[model samples]
Target: MRLGIIGVGHLASALVKGVLRTGFLTAENIVLAPRGHSAQLRAQFGCTIAEDNAGLVNACDTVLLAVRPQDAVAAVSGLPWRSDQIVLSACAGVSIADLAPYVQAAQVVRIMPTIAAQFGESATLVYPALPQLAPLLAALGKSYELKSEDHFEVGSVSAAIFGWAQALIGASSDWSSDKGMDRAQARALIAQTFISAGTMVAKTDEPVSQLLDSLATPGGITEAGLKHLENTAAIEAWNGAADAALGKLEKRR
Candidate 1:
């Protein structure tokens, strides 16, 4: 497949790496835009740059918009898009309605993914206004189609956990300092814990309560910790976060 990626930043870089490993798209077949857009990814993907967006658009069958949310409009606003071109976007808050007027393609798909995609473990929530595009993006990772645009906001909020996560690592690192544990080890430990938990969720169909029950035996340390977290308003904080994101999504629309 001939693919053109607009931006080659962190997430785009991760995608190119995984795409190469998965053999869905190769360096020779993949055309890229300038590093001014996806600088880091261009360096790592080892693919030829398209010189410009139109150059890539004209050359490739499938084009992915991997640019930042703000850049998306101006980047593609003046370009001549083709009906045959399929668009898979990783931009948050930009909807299919917002995109339709700018491009010639009838197909558009929006996906929310985690940084874990670099290693091939990603939790992706898809909001495709066009049902036909679902199969096209399946190769990227686990994808889900939601009934409404409102669903994307929920995932958008979920994706924002990256910021909070880094903060958590820093906080934990500071806490571990007096114990002589360094920042690197603390970061690695949290990274492993996050991945392991994600793996468990992906593999199991059972309820999370049941999963927790399995780990939390009576009077156990895990149970004690869980109880403390629950008491400390973590659940409430998470709920507010999701609700706040949904509100923001509504306002964006």
Candidate 2:
């Protein structure tokens, strides 16, 4: 199916790349748009670029709205969609109700995805009321059809508010600088540790407590570090971040 993207930004570019890289669409099938970055997307994805928003809607069967939250209402309100078209929105903190007045399309899927989608490893959460579009969302990530709009808001918060990883990384780089480690090596080590830890979590079915116990060995360096982390309130603070993020999303709409 032809996938027409409204915005040719980073996440949209990733979706375009992933679809083509994974053989979901052909160069002739995908259509981008009248926006400023259309040339870049056309170059990156080798697809035809539309000259206007109406042209984008008319060109494709499925439409992905990837613009920022601030621009969502005005952008979608401006689109003219056919009844046959399927709309999938990636704007965070914006509700289905927010777009309902703008378009007359039958099926609309609300999605929460991170930039990992560029590499096909995005943690995408879906709340699709229509079953026909269910498979399409599942292709993005492990999809979850939330029972209520409240939970979707919760996931939306988690998706947008989880950027504190940047804060953690920034703090660690400073510490490494103090230790005489150059910026490059410090950044590489930080990245490698995060990747390794994430891989460990993904591959194992073991309870994290059990895994940590094995590493700690009842007084080892891992245990010492773990104790220090707990005492310093790092883990608790991270939970606070997620909670705060959820609260913000719930208030937005």
Candidate 3:
């Protein structure tokens, strides 16, 4: 597949690296719009740099729309798109219907992939998922097929966790340092803990609550810690954050 990346920013760059690393596409088949950051991608991966967005679009069958949500319309609206071309949008809050007029393509799919995609570990989400797109999605990372636009928007609520997870890591690092642990060590240890937890979640079939129960044996340290967190309403605080984020997304609809 010949692919064109309209906005070669951080996320798009990661995706480019991932797809290349996974053998989803080759340097010869990929082209990117001319941007300051595009130079780095060209240097690192030898991806073709197009003279402009239109030039990139003309040369590729699949166009990845990675522009910022506010700039999406202006960026793709004037592009000379073909009816046979596929447009995959990575911009948040912009639905396929929202992008139809701008892209005017036969296929418009919305995707949400995290920065982890750069490392070939992103948990990507696709809306109005089609069977044909599975291979591309699989090459990037784990893919979830949401059946409707509403489901896709709601699925996006999980994206807020990147910031929240970083905040948590920072707080935990601070707590560890306050207890006389080395700050760098604390950071690495906590980061690894999250990674291990995520791996376990992916491998296990049991409910998360079952895992929690297994970890917190009666009268054990884990149980005590869990009780303390519960008393402080830590879980509720996380829910509140998720609710607030979901509310903002709902407002966009």
Best by lDDT: 3
Q: For model 3, where is the 10-residue window of minimal lDDT?
A: 97-106
What are the per-residue Cα lDDT tens digits for candidate 2 across 12-107?
776676566666567788888767567887776678988788888878888888888788878877677888887788887778888877878645
Candidate 1 accuracy as lDDT: 0.74
Per-prediction count of colliding residue pairs?
1, 0, 0
Instruction: State every prediction's TM-score relative to the real structure.
Output: 0.83, 0.85, 0.92
lDDT of each: 0.74, 0.75, 0.85
TM-score of 3: 0.92
Model 2 earns a TM-score of 0.85
If both were scored by TM-score, which would come out higher, candidate 1 or candidate 3? 3
Worst 10 residues of 1 by lDDT: 129-138
By lDDT, is 2 or 3 better? 3
Clashing pairs in model 1, backbone N/Cα/C closer than 3 A? 8-38
lDDT score at residue 240, model 2, on the 0-100 scale: 88
Lowest lDDT 10-residue stretch of candidate 2: 134-143
lDDT of 3 at 251: 70
Runs with alpha carbons beyond 4 Å of true place in candidate 2:
129-145
